[model samples]
Target chain A: MEIQRLSIKSLTITILIVIAGFSVLLSFVSGEYFFKAARESQLYSLNRVIQVATKEIMQQLHDQAYDIATALSIEGEIPKEFVKAVKGETKGELVKALDDPLITGFVGAYIIDLVKVRAYDLKLNFIAESHQGIQGLSPQMPKILYQQGYGRKGVARSKAISGLWQHADKSYYSVLVPIGGIFISGYLEVVVNPVNNLVRLSEKMNSPISIRSGIDPKRFYYEPKKSTEKLLPIEYELKTDLGASAFLLTSYEDIAKLSEGVKETVFNTISVFIGLVLIVLLIAIWLFQLLLFKPVNLMLNEIRNITDGDISRDLQVKGLAEIAILSGEFNKMTKEIRSREEVLTRLSVIDALTKIANRRKFDEVLKNEYLLGCRSGKPLSILMIDIDYFKQFNDTYGHLAGDDCIKKVATALKRSVYRPTDLVARYGGEEFAIILPDTTKSGERVIAEKIMSEIARLNIPHSSSSVDDKITVSIGGYAVVPSIHDDPVFIVAEADKSLYQAKGAGRNQFVLRNEFNSVI
Target chain B: MKKNYLISFIVFLLLVVSGIARAEKPFAPEKLQGTIRVDAEAAAELIVNTPSLLVVDARKEVEYSKGHIQGSVSLLDTEMTLEKLSKHAPDKSTPILFYCNGERCLRSSRAAAKALEWDYKLIYWFRGGWNEWVDKGMPISR
Candidate 1:
């Protein structure tokens, strides 16, 4: 048994959905990789921002320290003791002057935020200094004077050396400025606190922050914790200039938001893609109905009609080429079946020996003609013919020769009737009949005489015949305008009686009569 | 017109009465653990004497810019974070002095205690703050 196939529409939808599902899966995997790339880029940019901010804060510190140092150098220009102290002409003169309340007043009045100021001589000797730089730090020649950046080349070009120096347990920048104008007699060191600038650096970070400096709990800094699940903490160690542990900078960035956004974007895109695929699926099924299924269904209906016995139905092929071809082939098959049926019908009503209408055909034609005569009130005629002595002819010439003579008599008798309305049949062995519609009494007699002459014309030898040594027939015919009261059997019976009368008179003769009182 | 004026006068009287009724002190509490309370004169001395002293104005930016200690750094108390406090005073032993709008503002008191809580040892809160400093005609930056 053949398994029922899935419908074309169902098959189309299934194929389309499978393709869409595969595409969605492929894109989802690719999207995951794309999200990974995006996360990596974000982390890269975040690291860059950290480096840039650190550099900015350090630069700002140098700039502030540089500004203070330049001011101190200019203010100290008025004091002749600075010049004297720089040339080694006076060892403590600049110190003494800077220590005076009046000189302190003048300088403090000039620079408001000045915390510490140190003046050095040409030979890098501690010449004079103010007291307010870093707490517990005494005035001394900066050891950085001998450092690489501040050595002979620096002194020659008058370049400044700068950095955050840890003095008195405090970190601050000390900037050096030349005391004299272009001649460079000495250098001034101005201290700038880095605490304020460093504290404000938290503003550069986008997330909540914490910074732990060394092992000291006091130096450990952080924002209050709000959520542990959403905020993922991360830390990177910042090494100091001396290569020791500087601080552990920690932060909790809300990375879930980014991942969630990526997921939502992927979901929305997949949904739209599926939606589009579904629309295409619907369109495909409809197109199959229009361009394929409908035409095939039409052909199926025509075949169904043919199965129900409407063999004359011709199909109108339509739609796609394959279905049209199928319909065309079906029409050809039906035409062949109809022609075969016609041939079978013809064979059933024909005689084997005579090749003419058999007894059954003669009876059917007689009944039809009688009914037509009843309606039209016209004369209907029939002639029954018998061989004079066919049994003797068969004994003399053998059955095959007798059958040949009967076939010849059947053909000649058929030729005697001209109209298509007439029917000639072999009623039985060695017997024949003819039906003529719309014939008068005289018309019946004329047809009977014509059939006798036509049969005699064959001239087949019959040595056993009582009348002559040639094949011959005696005919009996009757004509009448029949009515509803008369049966076609009565007409056939009357014609048989007439055949008996002719046979009784003698062989090779006919008696023709009409039941109607009206003559020809 | 006379009746309207009378009603206006009555409303004004009610406002005055309410103002007097709600004249509560704006000063922060006098005592606090983990901190040393000092005056403006002591604060000034700490600035000049201590080499490692960090003066902080624990007030809003607007208040600090109006008039604050000359060497003080503005670290707003309301906006203070441990990272910010530690960045200013990384060493626990560093002497950090805090001040705000005199006795009327509690920002300095809170900020000074917050510093000590972060393990800083020397947390000084100047109770007199800017008011006493101005009254004494001490040096001003602006």
Candidate 2:
């Protein structure tokens, strides 16, 4: 099975995506933490404001209760009337005394909501209540009032006592004032409902406030209007003048809304952040393509052209510093390759010992020229030359001298050919051949005579010759107007045969044969 | 050898001075057992309501006369002998409240501890003491 590999482009994109994903996740987590912190701080401030407002309202209620208690206790006329009403044992008279204009007028002078007022005897038995419904005192009232130091003895000592009291369905803030001059009589109690004050408190604090009766859980008062969402049910047990235990429950939803706002801001910030990240990534990819990938691709194509034997042009230098340096280095490398290739090409065709075209080059040129001559109907000629008694010359002067003599002969023969189109090649050891592209039989004879004269002019010494005392060469020549049916090798064979004839006759002469087999 | 002796003498003098400084540091109160701790507000409330409550200023007579909570009587911790307490509070069941300068002062806690040892029925230790009372702007007497 083959596994697909990731390309650089795809890999870069994948890494960018991973980084973006991680950043988004980080933003989400931080946003959540920020929301939580903002929510907590909002709640804390809300709680503080509610506490201050509640304390102020409670203090106002306490002052009102104190004022009422002080007014009733210090007034000698009210205490005397209350004593008469109790002694007369007339319910109608006691009710009238309790609701007299002086007492009601004095109570009404304080503008706070005085829900109910009642009078109790020293034994804490019910005497008279201002509200319509008559009620007997709670059996636990005496014990609670005594424990709070607001009992009959407490009133005698402290002059007055105010406290909160809760029944089955109602809670009240009541002040107990002892009705006596020096000896204690019945008690005059003034009760006020705290719900109205709580309402004002709710408005001041901008949050919902309520009171729950600790003595009777069913009794709830001053509950704020209904809300969509409630938060932080802060319950504080109040230590007030009342004997009844009560608790205040307050909730603030604005803090929750503030947290929602924080979340919204966080989401918006994250969105903008992600958008910027994407833009940056795109720009980065574009820059990579422009500065690196494109330059690298151009360099790759240049290398391909070089391998394909088209190393004529150099690479263009451009782009960023590193890529430009790489391009320069690549160009230098291709130039070196081309120079080495030229040297190798030259070395492959030239004869190493004689500094002339070798046999292999000769064969390639002969084939190409023959084909050309056949098509053009041009007369092509070949000359074959041999060093006379070259082996005997070697046995006498040694092979080194023989080699020196051969070099001299090769040079002389090369000098004999005048036209640039003619070629001279070292045919073999002690042998040479020349190809002339456009020459007749007479022209071939002329070149062969010139080669013989040039070789004779060299005047090299050869000691062991059966013909002359110096080195000499035998030459053979052939010329023909090539036809399509003729082979180029046939010209070389004819020239070789002529060279055999020249060697057979003597050592120092030339022979030539024309296309029609006539000797010249 | 004389130079070595001189160095040793200097080292000994430094050690003695540091020891004296450590020993002269003021005493801090530790946790007290078998007592209920109250703040200035609760103590003031109790003093006002409970007639039998004895507010003992557990400092020296000079420190107590400088400033103290209203209705509180001076009763130094050093002078809180059994005979002295019995003379002031004939009934051992009377509520006794103790206080000093502040939390760092050990006099109030020590007096409360002595009262506990004497088997007083009710004991209240106002840890915030005279400093908190003045800070709260509560009524005080000199």
Candidate 3:
């Protein structure tokens, strides 16, 4: 079965595909890792920046609220009114004093979006508030302040405490301060809008900022105005002095746009990398074709021609080391094969024992010559010679000596036919046949006589022969101007009959048969 | 022809016998004794549960500092000495577990063999060591 083969072109293509595929995969993996690391690092820095910005905003708001509370308590009648309202003495007058321009203007100065001011009694009951619709008392207000060591025995004794507080869906930064002079009478609370603070911080940092208030955990505020596809958000929890939770989510300035540049650079680099890889692959393929494939293909063609019985030309050996060596070896192999074929051709037709054309070669030559004679209307002749009493000779002196006698007779017969066109062959045991092209009956007779005389001249000793004291041969000759209808075998049979006649008359004689006459 | 066949048959028989002689016995856990052989899980348990069990990282110090089994002390295979062993683990009878990179590493085995030669009463060889430990998500220390 013939196996499927991969040609050099396809094999190189496959290898190139695998290498290119691996390069693309490697680049994709490394590119993803690089982008991921860049995003993470940007997010980390964004988180730190957001934390610092949030702290600064909270500090500024806390100081402003403290100033407002301290001014109302030290220079105004609001604290005394708060004490009267707490003792239940002239509550309407206390309410009227709380609404005076001095206190109202001071509270109005600090009031803005989502910011509110409230005054609470020592019992933690709410007294007056800048914003309307607030409840009379907020019991949940000062809990974080007390936990952060800001409230002592239900009085604000420490510095102003700032924290995050929630109402419905909105969050506020609340600062609590004591409002009394000598003894603590009430607690003052200032709530400021964290969304405005975060927006200001975002502008100051030149980045996008969003706030996720711990009070209102489900809502986001101060979101930037941009597409967030490439933005890496960094989140940091804001912890005030009172340990309140306010989350700040921010990202680098134009983070989405910045990452686009990174992606573009990476894509460009990968394209160039792939281009370089393809260029290298093409160069490598050209080099291989020049240095290996071209030479190998030429050698292959030469080997095929050698198999087809044409081994005349040697391959041109030129390439790299291995291919050059291969070409050289292939040329050497073809030379060896040609020499061996010549030796085999010679061995096939020559008689191993007699050193003359064997029977098979005689038949081939007779047929070919007969066909040629028919075309040219030329006379072709055959002389069938045999050693007389050869069986008796073999019986008297063993087969080995009989073979030596036959070799001598065959050599004599070969010498008798001197024409270049004539052929002498060992027909069978003790019998020889000669093909004589363009020869007449008279010419055949002369050759027949010469062969008989030549073998008799050898004078090989034959002890048990009645023919002669020396070995001799009988010759029978047949000649014809062969027609297309005539078979060469008929002439061969006629020669054999004449050979029998010559032996019947006497050994060491010649006989001839032509178309019109027969002679002895 | 018959002699040729007889010679060929004798050659084939010799080939078969030689092939059988070259065959090895299958691994049996019972063949490994005199040293307690533990896997990564058992070694991690010994390090965590036994405070006195000296968990030794049998690799170079550079590799040890990169990452190793938690609470393991670096003791390289090439640096194994009686003095160094006594300095870290003075009590000869104290249980000691040695581990290296992984199953393909021979450092831990060599260190364990050396500890045995030192006449230590308890020596544990963690065959599947740091590689298996990290793969299994066990604790690691640098």
- lDDT to native, each model: 0.72, 0.75, 0.74
Candidate number achieving the greatest lDDT relative to the actual structure: 2
Model 3 chain B poorest ten-residue lDDT run: B23-32
User: Isolated chain A: TM-score per model?
Assistant: 0.66, 0.67, 0.56
Q: Top model by DockQ, which number?
A: 2
lDDT of 2 by residue, A44-113 (tens): 7767777787788777887766566555544545566567767865566556655553344653545466
* Each prediction's number of clashing residue pairs: 4, 4, 0
**lDDT by residue for model 1 (A139-160), tens:** 6644454363344532242445
Q: Give candidate 1's fnat, 2 decimals.
A: 0.00
Off by over 4 Å in 1: A1-209, A212-219, A222-278, A291-301, A392-403, A459-466, A516-520, B1-142
Question: Would candidate 1 be rated incorrect, acceptable, medium or high by CAPRI criteria?
Answer: incorrect
Candidate 2 matches the true fold with a TM-score of 0.56
Consecutive 10-residue window with the lowest summed lDDT within model 2 chain A: A149-158
CA deviation > 4 Å runs, candidate 3: A1-32, A48-204, A208-253, A269-352, A441-446, A518-520, B1-142
iRMS of each prediction: 15.1, 10.1, 25.1
Chain B TM-scores, listed for every candidate in order, come to 0.80, 0.83, 0.76
lDDT of 2 at B99: 94
**Candidate 1: lDDT over CA atoms?**
0.72
- Please write out the lDDT profile of model 3 over residues A1-520, one tens digit for every residue: 2335778767877898799879978887888887888878876777777778777877677655655655555335767777777887766655555445334455445533334556777655667665332343354565665565433532124234556665554556676666553235676666666666566776667766666656565677756677766555666776544455655455445677767777887888788888888888888888888877787787788778777877877878588898878878888888898889888987888898999999998999999999999999999999999898999999999999999998988889888988888999999999999999999988988898788778878889998889788898888888988888978999999999888889999877878898665674
Which parts of model 2 are misplaced by more than 4 Å? A1-4, A25-34, A55-196, A213-219, A225-246, A252-263, A284-340, A416-420, A439-459, A517-520, B1-142
DockQ of each: 0.01, 0.02, 0.01
